[model samples]
Target: MPKVIFHKHGQVFEDEVKPETNLVVRAGIKQFPYPNLRYECGMGKCSKCACKVLAGAEHLPPPNWKEKKQLGERIDQGFRLACQIWLTHDIELCQEEITA
Candidate 1:
C-alpha cells in the first residue's frame, strides 16, 4: 500500500491506499479523500483535480499526454492531474482550494 498525504485549505489528510490507486477514483467512490479532494470530471480534461506533488514524486512515472496537455508548464512546478496519476509509492500532495 501507498500512503497519501493530502493538504488543502491548511488542513492535512493522511491515508494508506492500495497500489495503483487513482486519487480521483478513490474520491469518487467516497473514500478517505472524498469531500476533501476537490474534483469534477474523472477524466484528465478537467484540471480541477490538479495538485502539487510535495514528496515522493520520483516514484511516479512521467506525466502522460493528458497531464501534459492539461498541466503544461505547471508540470515543471510539480503540479499533476490527480486523475492521471496512479499511486504505487507514498506521496504528498497539496491542492489549492477553489473559491467561488
Candidate 2:
C-alpha cells in the first residue's frame, strides 16, 4: 500500500491506499480528504477535480493524454486532474494553493 497525504481546508489527512486507487473515487468517500471534490463527468473532460501536487510528485505516474489536454501548461507546474490519476506511492497533495 502507498500512503497518500492530503491537504485541504486547513486539514491534513494521511491514509494508506491500495495501489492504483482512483483518486476521484477516494475523494467521493466521506472519510477521505477534500470530501467536497466535484466530478461532473467522472471522466477527464470536466477538469473540475484538479489538485496540486506539492511533494513526492515523482511517485505518481506520468500524466496521460487526457490530463495533458485538460491541464495544458499547468501540467508543467505540478497540477494534475485527480480524476485521471491513481495513487501509486507516497504523495502530498493540496486541493488549493496560494502563491505570492
Candidate 3:
C-alpha cells in the first residue's frame, strides 16, 4: 500500500491506501481525524476536491481528459481534482496550498 499525506488548516493527516485508491476516498477515510479536508463529490465533477501536489506529484496518475477539462485553467499550476487522482505511489497533497 502507498501513503497519502494531506496538509490543510495548518495541519497534516496521513493514511495508508492501496495503489488504486483515489484522493476523494482516501481523504474521506482519513478526514475523520482532520479538520482541513473538504470533499464534496466522490466523482470528478466537483472542484471541492482540488488539491496541490506539495511533493511526489510524479507518483500520481497522469491527468486524464476529464480532469484536464475540469481543472481547466488551473491545471497549469499543479491543481488536481481529488476524485480524479488515483495514487500509484506515495504522495503528499494539500488543498489550501493549491485552491484559490
Candidate 4:
C-alpha cells in the first residue's frame, strides 16, 4: 500500500491505498480524498485534477503526453494530473481550491 497525503483548501487528507491506485478513480468511488480531489474526465483530458507534488516526486514516472499538453510548463513546477498518476509509493501533493 501507498500512503497519500492530499492537501486542499487548507485541509490535509491522508489515506493508504493499494499499489497502482489512481486518485481520480478512488475519488470517483467515494473513497479517501473524495470531495477534496476535484476532478473531471478521468481520461486525463481535463486539468481539473492537477496537483503539485510536494514530496516523493522521484517515485513518479515522467509526465505523459496528456500531462505535457494539459499542464505545459507547469510540469517543471511539480504539478501532475491525479488521473494520470498510478501510485506505487508514498506521495504528498496539494491542489489549490478552484473558485467558480
- How well does model 1 score by local distance difference test? 0.94
> Model 4, 1-100: lDDT tens per residue?
8999999878888989999999999899999889889999999897999999999999999999999999999999999999999999999999987669
- lDDT at 29, model 3: 73
As a TM-score, model 2 comes out at 0.81
Model 2 stretches astray by more than 4 angstroms: 29-31, 34-36, 97-100
Check candidate 1 and list the clashing pairs.
none
- Across 1-100, the per-residue lDDT of candidate 3 in tens digits comes to 8777788878788877777776667457764323466778767777777888888887766787877878887777888887777777888887774435
Write out the backbone clash pairs for model 2.
Answer: none
List ranges where model 1 is wrong by over 4 Å.
Answer: none
Kindly list the per-residue Cα lDDT of model 1 for residues 1-100, writing each as its tens digit: 8999999989999999999999999999999799899889989998999999999999999999999999999999999999989999999999987669
Query: Which lDDT values do the candidates have, in the order given?
Result: 0.94, 0.78, 0.74, 0.94
TM-score of each: 0.95, 0.81, 0.78, 0.96
Q: Candidate 2: how large is its RMSD? A: 3.0
Error of 3 at 52 (Å): 0.5
Residue 31 of model 1, lDDT score: 97
lDDT of 2 by residue, 1-100 (tens): 8888877778787888788887788767754644645455658996877788998788788999999998899899898888887777777877774355
